[model samples]
Target: MLFDRRAPYDFFSVYHVPDVVTQRQFEAGIAASGWYDYFEQVNISGAALSPVGALLNNVALLPPTPQGPQIPPVSPITKQRVNVLGRTMTYADEGAGVPVVFVHGDVMSSFLWRNVIPHLDGQRTRSLAGDSDKLPDAGPGTYAFATHARYFDAWMEALDLRDGVVLVGHDGGANVTFDWAMRHEDQVRGLAFSEAITPPFDWEDWPAQMRPQFQYLRTAEGERDVLENNFFVNAAPQSITRMLTPAEFTEIVRPYAQPGEDRRPTTDWPREVPFDNDRSQTRTALEAQAAWLADTSIPRLHLPGVPGGIARLGGRKRRLISTWPSLIEAPVPGLHWTPEDAPHAMGSALAEWLRSLIN
Candidate 1:
C-alpha cells in the first residue's frame, strides 16, 4: 500500500496504529493541509482477503483522488513467493541475515504477526506460507489443513523462511515453535514462545468447562448440524463467554452451520483440524512432543500468563502452559494469563528477544 502525497485524517478501526499519517502529519510538518471527513475505511482479515480484494487498502495503498488532495509518500511493500514446504508460499520480507521464522498460530493466518514484522532493527526477514486453506475436500471424511503448521521441517519447503532460523510462536503456535527447535536443534539458533501451552493437562484446576465436545462425520445425516454447532462453540474466544454482545453472539459467531466452499469461517477456527492420518499415527506423533521438549537444549523462551484458550474439543487437549517450563530458565516477559492483553508490550518483548539472538 502506498500513500502518495496526502489528504485528511482518519482512524477507522479497533486495530490501533500510531504511525501518525493523519494529513496533519504531512501538513503540520511543512505545509498546512485540509480537514477531516467520515469516509469509512475498509477491512478484511488477510487469510480471507484476496490480494486483489477491495480491502487491500491498508494505509500503504490509500490513494489521492484527482479532485481531492494528496499527502506524504508511501509505497507498496513488494511481496515474494518462496517454495517452502513444496507450495509457492506468499509472504512479506525485508532486511537480511540470520533468519527468524515467526510462525503464525492456527485460526489466524499470518496476520497476527503484523505488529512485530515491521519492527525488527536489522538483518532479519519474515516469511509466511498461505497454507491456511483446507486441502481440496476430495470426500467427506478426508480433511487436511489440520493445524499442520505444527510440523516445522515439511512446512519449510513451502515457505522461504530464514534458514538457520530463530523460531517464534504464540498460543497454539508455541507448540510448533518449540517442537521445531526439538527436531531441528542444529538449524535453530534460538526459540521464543508467547502464551505457549504444552501437553500434560491439569483439569482439576480448570474453571467450569461446559462439557465434552464431540463431532460426527459428514455422512451422519441430522447429526452434522449438531457436530458443527458444538465445534465452533468449543473453539470460541473467551469473549464469547464474557463480553460478546447479542449481535456479536449471532453475527460474529453463529455461522459455523456446516460451512460450504464459499460461505466458510476461518477468522476463528472451529476445532483441531480433523486429523487426516489414522488415529494411531497421529497420536504417536502428538505424544512425542513432551519427549522432544525434555531433550531440547536450544536457547528458549516460555511465555505463559496469558488469557486461557479453548482447552479441549472431543478428547484432544489445548496447549497446557504448565506442562513445559523446564525448557526455559528465565520466563519470557509478560503478566500471567493476560500477556496478549497488551500487544505493544508483547511485540516489544518479541522484537527484543529476537535481537538478543546473535547480538
Candidate 2:
C-alpha cells in the first residue's frame, strides 16, 4: 500500500476489483523469487516534534528498508490487506507504538511522507567504536494512508489500531481529516492540517478590500472567466512549466490533466475532470471543505508551505488563514510563512518552537 504518483487507472480501486483470473499466491511468488533483498525501509519514531517554525523537523526514528532474501516472512516490509466493509484496503506497516496514519494532500500520494517517516521512528544501534548510539534506518511505526475516499473512515476502525492516534493531513487531505476528526474525535490524539482547504461555495467572500486580490466561483461563463483570469491564469506557472523538459512537464501535469484517463475519473470523483485543464470545481470543493474546518477548535499542528505565486493569491489568502485558527494561530503565532523569506527574524522563534517539541 505504498504511495506512488501513478495514474488512478494504475491504482486498483475498491469499486472495480481486477479479477484474479490466474493469481499467484504470495507464497508462490515468494518461493519463485527467493531473491527478495530490496523491500522498502521502515522508521521507528521516538520523539515529539514541536509544531512551531521548522521547514522540516529532524525527527529521531528508524527507517524502513526493502527486505532481503534472508529476512524472515514477517519482516518489516511486509504488508497485507485486511477486510473493511468487505473491501480490501492494503496497508504497509512497521515497528510497534501508538499508531499514526500518514495522509496525503491533493496531487500527492502518501509517497510524500516517505522521507518524513524515517526522521521520527524510535529504534537505534550503538557504534562498534563505542562512541555513540544511533537509531537504525528500518522505519517508524506502521503508517499508512493508502485508501481511496469512501473506505478511509471505515478502514481506520477495522485496523483496530492504537486507541489514540495522531493524523497528518496536507492540502486537499485536510478536508478528509476534518470530517473524520469530527466523527471520531476520541480516536484522534492530535490533528494536523497543511494548506487547509475548503469548498469555494462554502467560504465567506473575501472582504471587499481583498476581493480584487482574488477572483473565484466559476459556475458560469462570467464566473469562469473570473477564475480563469484571476485563478488559473495567475495560478498556473506557464512560464516555469514550459521551461521543463517535455517529459518532466508531462509527468507532473498529466496526472491532474487526464487523471484515470481523458474520460475516466479516479479517487472517488465520478468523472475524470481535467482539472489541470478545467481548473473548475476544484476551488468550489476546496472552499466547502475550508468552510467546514474554518475554525478547528481542536488542539492541532499546522505546517503550511507551497510553490510561490498563484497558490497564495487563489488559495493562501482565503483557505490557509480561514482553516487553522484553533490549531495554528492559537498555538504558535510567531513563525513566518516562509522561513527562507525571513530566516534571521524567525530563527530563534522557530527553533524554540521546534526544540520544545523535539525534547
Candidate 3:
C-alpha cells in the first residue's frame, strides 16, 4: 500500500502485488528512485489473503489510522455577496437543511472555515460563513461589539435566516455571537465557541508570554504596526501551532497588503479588549453575555484546545465548562486557532453538536 504520512486517512488501503518477485522489484524501484523513505511494505499471507475484500487482517503491522474526522483539502468556495447595513458582505453559503452560521474573529475572514465547513454533513445541514462588515473585504464599518452584532442581525435579515440557526464563533466573533444571541434568543437554536473572548476575564488570565504582545497592540506603536506594517496579518502564525505554508500566508494577508487607514478594524479590535475590570463598552457587552450564558438554556458547544490562546487558559476554560449548565466541551489539539490547527476534530465535534440540536 502506498501511504502519504501527511494525508488524513480513516482506513488503510491494501494493494495485492501478485508475487514476491514483483514486490522485490517494486521495492528495488522505489529504493533506486531515492523515494524509499516515503514508502513502506508489509507482507500478509494465509487468512489475510482476501485481496478482493481489500481489508487487512494483520492491522497491527500497519501504520495507525488517523483519529477524528478526516479533513479534506481546502477547496474553493463560491463567494456570495449581499447588502447588509449598507455594506456589501461576502459569505460562503453551501449545503442544505438546518442553517449554521460561522463568524470569524480578527485578522481573518470566512475563509477561516474553508476546511471546517466541508466536514459537516452537507445534506443534513447548511453551512454559512461570512466576512463581517468590519473586515477589509466586507467593506468598512464600526468595530465595536454592539455595532458588529447589529450588523450580524442585518446580515441574517438580508439572508432571510430568522429561525433554527446555529451560531458558531471564534475569537471576537464569539462576543458578537453572544451579543446577537442575547437580544434575539428566540431566533437562535444553539451556540458554539472556540477561543472565544466573551465573559470578560481579568488581564492576568492571558498567557504570560503573550501578554507583552497584547499590551503592545493596545498602544501607539501597535497602531503603527497594524496600519503600516500589517502586524496582525503577519503575527497570525504566533496564534497557531503549525507554520502556515507560503500559499496560505499569502492568501491570508492579501486583503491587508497595502498600508493605510483601511486597516483601522485590526487596530480597533485589539484596543477593544478589556482589561483589569475596565468599564468600556466591549467589557459591558462581554459581561452581559457572560450573565446570559450562565442563565440561558440554549444548547452550547465549547471547542477548546490544549494550551489555547486567550480565553482557553486553564481557569477560564474550567469556569466556562463548569459554570455554563448547558454547554458541551469538545477539546481538540491546538493552541489559539483551533479551527486552523484542528479543523477535522473541531468540525466533527461541531457537526455532532449541531445535529443533536436539530434532532
Candidate 4:
C-alpha cells in the first residue's frame, strides 16, 4: 500500500534546536535523531515508498515550496441545481447514451469526480453532490447507510433512473451505493467503487497509527479539532500524490471553511462510522450490504489504488474483494483520493471497465 497507516514517529528533533539554528545545522540534528535512525533502517526504496520518503524528507527539511507536481484544476463544467426529495442537490448532468451516476462520500461533494466525469466520453453522467438533506427526521434512525440509501434511492427514483444505469461511488458513497444495489439490483447496470469501507472490521481493526485518529473523532474534543482547523480539507490533501494548487485547495475547503451548521456534515460523518457492532441501523444495514456484495452477481468493478487504495490499512482477507467473485479488480496509482492523485489513470480504468461490461 502506497499510503498505509503511517507510524507516529516523532520528528521533533528539529524543533528542539535553538531558533537561530541554520538549515544545515538543523539537518545535521535531524539526521542524528533516533526517529531519523529508525526510518533509515526501514527499506523505503521503490515506487511504493517514494511518496512516503518524500513526505518524510519534507518534514525533516521543511521545504519552502512543494517539490512535486501540483494537482491540476478540476475539469471545466457547469454545475446545475435541482430539488430532489425536498432538498436542493447540486450535480453535473451531461453527455448522452447510458446514464452514469456518481455518488461522493463525506467531506466532499460531487466535485470529487470532476476530472473523471469528462473522460467518460460518450456516456451520460450525473454527479449528485454538495449539501445533502439531513437524514430523515425519523428519531434515532438517523444512521448513515439506511439514511443515505433512502435519500439516494429517492433521488434516483425522482430522476426516473432504472435499468442500465451505471453507478460509481467513492468512500462513504460506496456504502450508500452498495446498500442501494442490495435493494435495487435489478435497476443497476454496473457498479464501481473505490476507497469503500466494508466490515467484519471496526475502529479496533484500524492500524495502530490510525486507531487514535478514529478514536479521537468519537469525542467532543475531536469535533472541535475538525471544525476549528478544517481538518478534512487540510489533512486530506496530504493523501494525494501531488500538492494541491492554491485555487484547488480553496475550492475543496470552501464547503467546510466556515463555522456553522455547514460544517456539520464533516463532523457527523466520522462519528457515524460503524466502528462498533450493535443492532443499530447503520451496523445492520452495512452488515447486510457487505454480505450482498460478496454474493451479488451484478457486474462490479473494484478500482484499487496503487499500494492498496482503500484496502491498504485493511489486509487482503478483510477486503471486500476477498469474497466478491464478480468484482473486477483494476489496480491504479494513487492513494485514497485517486481522483486528485491519478485522475487520468482512474478515468481510463473506469471507461475501459464500463466498456468491457457492455461487450
* Candidate of highest lDDT: 3
Tens-digit lDDT track of model 1 for 203-266? 3322243223222322243234434444433344332212222433343333333454312233
Task: Please give me the total number of clashing residue pairs in predicted model 2.
Answer: 49
Model 3 segments beyond 4 Å from truth? 1-74, 133-141
- Superposed Cα deviation of residue 98, candidate 2 (Å): 2.3
Query: Which stretches in model 2 have alpha-carbon errors above 4 Å?
Result: 1-78, 123-149, 199-296, 306-323, 329-359
lDDT of 3 at 261: 64
Evaluate model 1: give its TM-score. Answer: 0.55
Tell me how far candidate 1 lies from the true structure as C-alpha RMSD in angstroms. Answer: 12.8
Candidate 4: residue 79 Cα off by (Å): 1.7
Per-residue error (Å), model 2, residue 192 = 1.5
Error of 2 at 344 (Å): 20
TM-score winner, 1 or 2 = 1
Across 33-110, the per-residue lDDT of candidate 3 in tens digits comes to 876466564433211122211222123243432433323334478888898877889899898888889999888888
lDDT of 2 by residue, 1-359 (tens): 97574443432312211222212243346456753364432222211113322222223121322221121111133345667656455565544565556555433333334333433345221000000011123122111122333456766767764356656564445556766776666766666544444333322332232233233322334233422233322222231211223433343344345312221111222121112234444444444445655554555665544222212334534345645555542221111122222212222332233333334
lDDT of each: 0.43, 0.37, 0.73, 0.66
**Candidate 1 residue spans exceeding 4 A from truth:** 1-79, 83-88, 123-131, 138-152, 158-163, 202-237, 240-258, 261-280, 307-340
> What is the full ranking by lDDT, best candidate first?
3, 4, 1, 2
